[model samples]
Target: MSNYEKYLETQLQDLDFKEEYDNLEAEYQIIKAIIDARLELNLTQQELSAKTGIKQSNLSRIENGNCSPTVHTLSKIARGLDKQLVIKFV
Candidate 1:
């Protein structure tokens, strides 16, 4: 597990933190997926920014898990990458 994952396990001990963490888990996963997708395509932040119309600095923040992007923003990114955003429940 990652350091962040370990930290979350500890936070889950606290009911309030657990609730908030649970709510944000999906968002975090999406951030990871976005970064991974970019890397898989061997695209630089600058390149992706040009494709997505998002600033490179903002893209850095988003990939670093420091920013929360809206669904529309994510869709823009997906389109730039020649991918589609698909949400699923399991």
Candidate 2:
């Protein structure tokens, strides 16, 4: 591995760093999935906001996973994107 990568791996060996990294990675995955779905529908955040009647800023927050969207809000967003939201319980 490259020096930088090795350094990161070494740092991630710490419990706190590993937990934080895992959380961030999970958030990144969710955001990426949302962005990918939006791209698949060729809809920008503004377009999604217009269709769902949700504010663009709120959509931004949702994409960032900084804001938790209600079930109704998520349904609206999925409908705006011509998709459906599925939740699986483990």
Candidate 3:
């Protein structure tokens, strides 16, 4: 590789970004999955709230992955969206 490319790579490696990267990556995945499921049902936040009996703000937070949803809340959302919530360990 070129010197510039190597230097950039070295800088990236020198930065301890694993924790930040992992957190952001997991949050991205969670939000993406929720958004995808909601989109599949053609439901807006308001509509989802209406169906799930959850407040729009709470739904928004959950969809954004800014809040960790409880199992009961997730189950309600999944039932409202006609989806299933599954938790797994990697």
Candidate 4:
């Protein structure tokens, strides 16, 4: 494995670190989904901002994991991407 991957693997061996990492999994998934969907549609943050009426800065923050987006914001983003937002607990 690469140095960073090896380091991360070692770090994850700690119960505390693993717990924290697992807790953030959902947030990471949300960020990945937004980024992937935007790329799939070939949409820039600015373009998405126009479509969703949300600020490009806010979108950037969300994508960067600097802030948590509300369900309303996520719904807006989904519509802007011509998608439907679905949340599930499993």
Report, for every candidate in turn, its global Cα lDDT versus the true structure.
0.84, 0.79, 0.76, 0.90
In order of lDDT, best first, we have 4, 1, 2, 3
What tens digits encode model 1's per-residue C-alpha lDDT throughout 1-90?
A: 655558757878999977886888887788767866887799999999999899999888887778888889889999888899998899
Clashing pairs in 4: none
TM-score quality measure for candidate 4: 0.78
Over 4 Å off in model 4, which ranges?
1-19
Using TM-score, rank the candidates from best to worst. 4, 1, 3, 2
Task: Show pairs that collide, candidate 3.
Answer: none
- Would you estimate the TM-scores of all the predictions? 0.70, 0.67, 0.69, 0.78
**Number of residue pairs clashing in candidate 1, backbone atoms closer than 3 angstroms, sequence gap of 3 or more or interchain:** 0
The candidate maximizing TM-score is 4
Candidate 4: tens digits of C-alpha lDDT, residues 36-56: 889889899999999999999
lDDT digits (tens) for residues 1-90 of candidate 3: 544336435645644654564557666566667777888778999999999999999998887567988889988988888988887879
**Model 2: per-residue Cα lDDT at residue 77:** 84
Q: What does the lDDT read for residue 39 in candidate 3?
A: 82
Cα TM-score of candidate 1: 0.70
Q: Which stretches of candidate 1 lie over 4 Å from their true place?
A: 1-23
Q: Model 2: number of clashes?
A: 0
lDDT of 2 by residue, 17-86 (tens): 8888787875555566677788778899999899999999999998867876777887888889888888
Off by over 4 Å in 2: 1-18, 24-29
